[model samples]
Target: MSQWQQPGDRRTRGRVLRWNLAGWILFGLLPQAVAVLDASPARRYWLLGLLVLIALCHTVVVNRPDNPLLRHGTYLHLLALVLGSTAYLMDGGAAFYVVSLPQFWLFTRAPRDAITLSGAAAALTVFGGTLHQGWSPQFLTGNVISTVVACVAGAGLGLWVHHFVVRSNERQEQLTAALALTQKELAAAYQQQGAAQERERLAREIHDTLAQGFASIVVLAEAARAAAVNDPVRCAEQLTSIEQTARENLAEARVLVGSAPESGVAAGSLAITLRRTLDRFAQDTGLTVTAELPDVDLDQRTRVALLRCTQESLANVRKHSGASTVGVVLTELAGGVELEITDDGCGFVVEDSRGYGLDGMRRRLAELDGELSVISSLGDGTRVLASLPTHSQDRA
Candidate 1:
C-alpha cells in the first residue's frame, strides 16, 4: 500500500510541475522562436539580440509583483517584442506581425497587466507593419482596423481568464479554512461524547454496588432505632452492621473511581471520601457526625446520587447552618432509594436561600428522575429529603 501511494503522489507532483513548465515555456520561449522564424539575416541579429535580452530579463532574476524590478521585466519583455516585430517589418510586406507573443506574458506572470501590454504590443505591431507594407491610406486603414479588432478581442479574453483565476484562488482558500474548522468541531464533538460515556459508566457502577450497600445501612439503622428500647446490645450490633455496610460500599466506590487498591487513595469512595469529609466537618465546626447505612442491592446511579447529595447537603450545613449535630440517613423505600440529611442548626428560610447547594441538588436529582424536599426556617433545624426514581420513572 505504501508503494502504491508513493507512486500516486509522485505522479500528481509530476503533473503539476509539467503544467507550470508548459505555461512558462509557452510565454517565455515562444517569442524567441517567432523572432527566429520571421527575421531575415540582416534583421536576425537585432531580433535575436532582443529575444536574448527578454530571456535574460525573465531567467536569472525573480519577478516580484510589487517590486520595481517587475516593471523592468515587463519593459524588457515588451521592448524585445517591439524590436523583434520591427526586424520582421523591415523585411518585405510583413503585415501580420504584432505584439501577439508579448501578450502571452500576461497569463504566465501578472494576469492583471495582460490587457494593457497585449493592446500596446498589438498597436505597435500594426504601426510597424503598416509602415513597412507601404503607408497607403487603403492598406494602412484596413490593417489598423484589423489590429484594433484583434487587440480589443484578445484583451477582453485575457481579462476574463484573470478574473477566473483570482476567483478560483479565493474559493480554494475559503474551502480550506472551512475544512479546518470542520475538523476542529468534529474533534470537540468526539471529546464531549467520550465524557458523556464516562459519566454513564460511573452511574452504572454506583447503581450496581454502593446503592445496595446504602439500602442495607438504612435498614440496619432503622432496626437499631426499633431495638434501642428493647435491647441496647442489639442496637450496638445494628450500628456495627451499618458501619460494615458503609465500609463495604465505600470499597466498591473506590474500585469504580479507578483508584489503585494498594496506595489506599480510594479516589473519593465511601471509605476514604465519606470518612474524611465527615471528620473534617466535625473537626472544623463543633458539629457531631451521625450516619445510618444498611446493606442492600444498590444501582450505581443511585449510589452516586445519594453520595453526592449527602456531600453537598452536609457542606451546606457546615457553612450555612450553625448546627451541633448533622444526621445522615440512607434508606430503601418501598421500591426506590431515599437519603435524608437533618442538621440541628440555625437554618434559614428555603425560599430565600442564596446558596447553590439546593439548586445543585435539584439539578442532580433531575437527571436521575428523583425528587428533593427541603424543610427549614430561621433558628430551626434544616432537613433535606431526596427520593430516587423507580425503575419505571421516565428517563428521557
Candidate 2:
C-alpha cells in the first residue's frame, strides 16, 4: 500500500504467508492440539481457547495483509500467545516461538521495526520460560541456549532479507525513471526531425513557384524598358506578360498557404500546361522553342512534380545557355513517363555546378519515386531528363 511497495512485494509477502501458515499448522497448531488430548481439563480448555485465538489472528493476517493496523496488531497478539504458551507449557511451547519468528519480518515495513519487535519477542520468550523453570541447569542448557541461538540466527536472516528487498525496490525505481526519460527524448527527436523536414518542403515550394515567377517578371520588365520608345507595342506585350506571371505567382502563394484548393498547374492537362509555359517562355525571351507534348494520365502530385522540373530546366537554359533554340519533349515509356528538355546552348561541367535549382528538381522528382539526370559538357548541348514510373507501370 505504501509508495515504495510494488505489486511484486505484495506477491512475495503472500508467498511467505502461505509458507508461514503451513509451518503454523504443522508445528504450532497440530502439536498443541495433540498435547491438549493428554492434559488436565483446565489445560485442555486453555490450549483449545489459545488455538482458536491463534487461528483467528492468522486468518486476519493472511486475508488482509494491506491493513497495517490489523496486521501489526495480530502479529503482536500472536507473539503474546507464544510467550503465554511458553510459560504454561515450558519446553513444549518453545517450538511455537521458533515458528512465529518469520512474522516479525513479514508484518513490519522498516528493518528497525522488525528488529525491535523480534528482539522484544525473544526476550519475552526467554522470560516466560524462566518464570516457569526458575533458572534450572537443565532448562538453561537445553531451552535457554537453543532460544538464544534461534533468536540470533532469525535476526541475522531477517536483516539480510530486508536489505535485499530495499535494494531491489531501489533498482526497480531507477529503471522506471530511466525508461520514462528515454521515451521523452525519443519524442523530442521525432518532433525536431518533423520540423526540419517541413522547413525543407517550404523552401522547395518557394523556389519552384514564387522565386521562378519573380525571375520571369524581372526579365520581362528589363525587355519592356528597353523597347518602350522604339516599339511601344512590344513593350506593352512584355508588360502584360509580366502582369500575368505576377498574378500566377500570387495564386501559387495562396495554394502554398492552404487558401487555394490546388496548385496552378494542377487544374489542366499536363500537356496543355507545359505547352502554355513554352509559349509564354518563347514570347517573353524571343527564343525558338519547339515541343512534342502529349497528354499523359497522371495524379496531381506527379503532374506538379513534372511541371516544376520543366520550369526549372527552362529557367536554367534561359539564364546559362547562350544557345538560341530549346527543345521540349514529353513521351510515355514502357510502364513510365519521361520528359526531356534539351538546349543547343553553351554547356558547363555538371559536377562543378553548385546550384539549388538542380538539387531541388532532384528532390521533387525523388518524392514521386522519379529521377532527374543532367548530361552535359563544355561545347556540348545539355540534356535534362526527368522520369517517373506510373502506378500501372509500377504494378507491371
Candidate 3:
C-alpha cells in the first residue's frame, strides 16, 4: 500500500506468505492431526473443527492486516485456542502451542504487540499443561521451558527483522526523492539550453540578412540625396536601388518572423546569386569588382553559408577597406567547394579583429562542418576563404 512498495516487494511478500503457510501445515496441522489419530471420535472431530476455525481466522488476519478489529481479535482468539487445546488434549495438544508461536509475530504490526501476545500464548500454554499434569517435572522440562524459550527468541528475532525492514524502507524513500529531484533539474537545464541556442540562431539570422540590408539602405539613401539635382538620372537609379533593398529587407523580416517559409536566398545557380550580389555592391560603392563563379552543385545549407560569408565579407570591404578593386572567386576542389573574396583595401590584422559579423560567418560555416579563414595584415589586402565538404552536395 505504501508508495515505496515496488513490484519486486509485492512478489517477496507473496513468497513469505507461502513459506509461512507451509510452516503451519508441516509443523502445526500435520503433527496434531497425526497425534489425535487414536483419540475418541467426538474429541477428534471437535479438535479438527477448532483447527479449521483457527485457519479461517488466520486467513482473515492475513488478508486484512491493516484492519485493527480483525487483527487484534484474531490474536486473542488464537491465544484462547492455544489454551483450550493444551488443556483439552494435554500432551497431545502441546505441539499446537509451540507451532502457533510464530502467528503472534505474523498477525501483529508492532514489535510490542507481537511480544505481548506471544508471551501471553506461552503463559497460557504452560498453565494448560500444568492444570492437567499437576506441575510434573517431565511436563515442565519438555513443554514449559521450551515454550518460554521460544517466546523470548521469537520476540527478539521479530524485533530485529522489524528494525531491518523499517530502515530499508526509509532508505528507499530517500533515494526515490533524490531521483525525482534530479530528473526535474535535468529537464529544466535542457529547456534553458534550448532557449539559449535559439537566441543565438535568431541573432545570427538578423545579422546575416536584415542587418546587412538596413546598412545597404543607409548607403543608397545618402548617395541618392547627394546626386539629387546635378545627377537626376543617377539619383533616380539610387532611389530604385533603395526601393528594391527595402522590399528585400521586408522579405527577410517575414522569414525571420515565421510568416515566410523559405529563406531570403532564392533557389538558383549559386554563381548567378553571387553575381547579382556583386553587381549590387558595385552599383552602390562604385568599386571595381571582378568575379569567376562557375556553376557548382551544393545543398541548401552549404549554399546559404557561402552566400552569408560573401555578404559579410563584402560588407567589411565596403565599410573598412578603402580599396579600389575587389575580386570574388568560386572554385570546386577534389574533396569540396570553396569561395574566396579578396580586396586590395587597407586590411586590418585578422587576429586583432573581434567582430560579430566574422564570428557569425564562422558559426554558419561550422554548422555545415565547413570552415572560414581570413587572411590580412595592416598594409596588405584581405582574403576571406570559405570551404564546405562535398558530402552534403545536391547533385540534382
Strongest candidate by TM-score: 3
Evaluate all candidate structures by whole-model CA lDDT and list the values in order: 0.61, 0.80, 0.79
Please write out the lDDT profile of model 3 over residues 155-188, one tens digit for every residue: 8887787777778888877999999999999999
lDDT of 1 by residue, 1-396 (tens): 111112235566345435544554465346555745765775667655655665455443323224453553455356536543653445321233333333244324554455556655666666665656767676556666666676676667666755665676677779989999999999999999999978865664464356645755676778789989998987887787778668877777778767735221232333344556566446434468987766434555555567677767765765567788888777777888787889988888889886555676776788888999999998989999999855533221
Model 1, which residues run further than 4 Å from truth? 1-42, 60-112, 130-149, 166-195, 225-241, 251-396
TM-score of each: 0.46, 0.80, 0.81
Task: Give the worst 10-residue stretch by lDDT in candidate 2.
Answer: 1-10
- For this target, which candidate reaches the highest lDDT against the unseen true structure? 2
Model 3, residue 111: C-alpha shift (Å): 2.8
By lDDT, rank the candidates, best first: 2, 3, 1
lDDT of 2 by residue, 1-396 (tens): 222234375677677678878887888778777866887787778777777776777777687865554544456656655655744653434566677777766666666777677777777777777777778898787766776777788889977776776788788879989999999999999999999998999898898889999999998999999999999999999999999999999999998888987765755479999999999999988899999998888767778888999899888987889879999999998888999999999998999999999999999889878999999999898999999987633220
lDDT of 1 at 18: 51
Backbone-clash count (model 2)? 0
